[model samples]
Target: MSPAPPTPAYRRLSVEERRAQLLDAALSLFAHRAPEEVSLDDVAEAAGVSRPLVYRYFPGGKQQLYEAALRSAAEELRHCFDEPHEGPLLPRLARALDRYLAFVDGHGAGFTALLRGGSVAETSRTTAIVDGVRRAAAEHILSHLRATDPGPRLRMTVRMWITAVEAASLIWLDEGKQPPAGELRDWLVEQFTAVMGVTAARDEQTAALVRRVLASEDG
Candidate 1:
């Protein structure tokens, strides 16, 4: 009757739901090991679906699956920037550091795989994930700099700040994650604020420009 209620327009899912489903499937495989090592059948089994179903979402197969996992990690890191905090850089920096640490704590395997980049499937995955993360960090630092300095040197300063933070985190992870989470968090906040002039700036003059660029690009 009524043309079968129009099938509710096929009930298209929201993009977020589809993305979550894909990420769940990929993350499981990544947790196990390299995407190349994990077959489509394995991913389907992990996701509790048929092989064709997984292919339906990711036609590129293993490579696509690995990329999805990498994208998921990037999205998680991007979440830290979505917070709407208005204050000195230290608090914001601390909040971001806490968020990052929490993500690593929750998704240890995902983070580790992303960081190591050993496997063929994981190599590209790692590159994509790290690029996204580095961009986010650079953009955050750039915003703080523009808010304070607003000069030609802001870009270089942003790059240095981001690289420093990334290097520190990488070293910490390489050295067995020992220094304690609290101590690491404090250090990250202090280092970011000290290098980026977060407390000295009243507003993010460059955030608008960066946001425009991000809104245009998917990564």
Candidate 2:
């Protein structure tokens, strides 16, 4: 029988490769299930490794693994808005939303776990990680507006849009991603323009930004 095809030799992974393997497995679980619903055994089994090996890598247990997964997700979320400044502002925003919403759709339950408080695995560090993503998103929006030193009103307007985006994302997940992602993205872009218009009525900086955006669109 050809000696069972001479069983292939097992190759060992480097430390970084092994860690990434475990993180990918854990993140996959966390992406579809709540942090509390996931266990190290699930991760170990997914990674084709033993529980001791998981514990060996993450001595702080599931909490540590959860935090690591959250950080990795946060890093990706922060970069979702890092688009080139080559297009009209609204189109740029739309492109950024496309990436952000794709992440939201892909992560679903994990996104909920990260944003919604009350998980057993919640910690100050995890909260900070989530908050960092929000702050980074706000900053990116401000940069897109070309506002280096945004006034209080302009800053609040931008931040409020960021908050609204987050709330809408959560709602989208709850509604089973209804309204379609492309529709939602376009709607969000409109909301930003509308909110900026409302703020521009009272804030000179926002007013100027609106004019520049309009001129760009016209151009």
Candidate 3:
């Protein structure tokens, strides 16, 4: 064998790149462990950097890093419901749920840490971040329903479904993700349809939506 090849020199990352690397490491740690349990040292080690280096990028320390990580996760969760308008509404919703559930599954304990709301790392800003995700998801669903300016009943129905999705997601995690994800997705779609049908009985807007959905399905 030839003599050991020359090792490449370490390349320096730009400020943004280095910050992103730190954030990714922090997020990964936060993904499996509660933010309160994770430390700045852990993030530094995970990123293969020194603790001082981590502080250099995040002067506010672990709280700052945790907030940043929460923001990143929140952005991803918000995008999960941003499905295209081309498909049947249920199918679109199913696809969005697939993405959302996948995030929940991947994040595992992190999902609980973010949503459970009693962690030491929890802050008003972080709470707002989580709320923003819920609002964004509701908006996406409303848009998919073609309800640009939904009335109180329609809006409440859509928001209720969103809350149910969150509750079901938490329950799924507690149940160790039993019944499989596809089954969960289908069940959620069914639940949405059922809830909308019940609401339609008393709400004209929901009734019109049900008729449109039925026509689409019949077609």
Each prediction's RMSD over C-alphas, in Å, is 9.5, 2.2, 2.4
Best by lDDT: 2
Write out the backbone clash pairs for model 3. Answer: none
After superposition, the stretches of candidate 3 with alpha carbons farther than 4 Å from their true spots are 1-10
Q: How many residue-pair clashes does candidate 1 contain? A: 0
> What stretches of model 2 exceed 4 Å from their correct place?
1-11
lDDT of 2 at 155: 88
Q: Residue by residue across 164-219, what tens digits does model 1's lDDT show?
A: 76566666666877687779888876665454454234335444444533343333
lDDT of 2 by residue, 15-117 (tens): 8988888888998898899999999999988888889999999999999999998888888887898899876888889999999999999898999888987
Ranking by lDDT: 2, 3, 1
Off by over 4 Å in 1: 1-19, 122-129, 145-154, 174-176, 193-219
Predicted structure 3, TM vs. truth: 0.93
Residue-wise lDDT of candidate 3 within 1-219, one digit each (tens)?
887754321348898988888888888888788888999989988888888988988899989999988888898888888788875678888899999999999888888889988999998999999999988988888887887778898888888998898888888988989879999999999999999999999999889988888777665
TM-score of each: 0.68, 0.94, 0.93
